[model samples]
Target: MEFYKLKANPKRLFLLDGSGALVSAFFLGLVLPSFGPLCGMPKNVLYLLSVIACIFALYSFACYFFLRRNRKPFLRGIALANLSYCFLTIALLCRYSQSLTIFGWTYFGLELFIIGILIRFELKYASVR
Candidate 1:
C-alpha cells in the first residue's frame, strides 16, 4: 500500500471543480423534482439540499476567482470551506438517514465520495509543498 500525494495545477483544479459543482447543482436542484420520489428524498429535504448544492457551486466559482488573483489565503479559505461543507453534508446525511430512501442513500453516498476526492485535492494543493 502506498499513499500518493495529490498533485495538479491549482488553477485548473479550481476550474474543473467549479464546473462539476455547477453541474451537480443543476441536476440536484432542477432535475430531481421532475420525477418526484425518484430521488428518494423528501420534497423539503430535496429542496434544501439542492439549495446547498447551489451555494457550494457558487463558492467553487469564488475559488476560481481567488485562484485567478493568485491569492493563497483566499484559496486556503475556499479549501477549508469545502472541507467544512463535506463534513457537514456527511453529518446531515447520517442524521437524516431515516428520511432517505434507498436511492437517496445511494445518491448521497456517491456525492460524499466525489466530495471526498475533491476535498483531498484541495487540501493537498492548498498546503505548503
Candidate 2:
C-alpha cells in the first residue's frame, strides 16, 4: 500500500505500528534471546528491548482501538517512541559491537531501516491536517 494515501485514514498507522512492535517484541523477547550466542546481545538486554516493544505495541493498539479523534498527538507519540527505540538499538549495537556477530548486525540494521521508514510515515501523516 502506498503510504501517502494514509493521509485520508491515519488510524491505519496504528495498526501497522502495533503489528511491527508485536513482531519486534516476539523476536527480541523470544527468538533472538534463544540464539544469544549467534546474536551476541545479552539475553537480559534483549528482554529489556522486548519489554519496551511490548509497551509500544500496547500504546499503538490502544490508540487504534479507543481513540475516536484527535490522533495526531498519539501518532507522533509512537513515532517518537520508535525513534527512541532505534537510538537505543544503535547504542546497544555500538556497545556490543565486539561481541555482535554478522547476524546481529544484519538484524538490527534491517530493523532500524524498517522502523525509520515507519517513523517517516507516522510523522508525515500526523503532520497532515
**Top lDDT model:** 2
In candidate 1, where is summed lDDT lowest over 10 consecutive residues?
A: 1-10
Which stretches of model 1 miss by more than 4 angstroms? 1-8, 65-69
Candidate 1 C-alpha lDDT tens digits along 1-129: 011422445666666567767766766777776668776565666666677767766776777675455545655666676677678777877777776777777877887787777766666666745
**How large is the C-alpha RMSD of every model relative to the true structure?**
3.6, 0.8
Model 2 stretches astray by more than 4 angstroms = none
Q: What residue pairs are clashing in model 2?
A: none
The CA lDDT of each predicted structure is 0.67, 0.93
TM-score for each prediction? 0.76, 0.97
Alpha carbon lDDT of residue 77, candidate 2? 92
Q: Per-residue error at 119 for model 1, in Å? A: 0.5
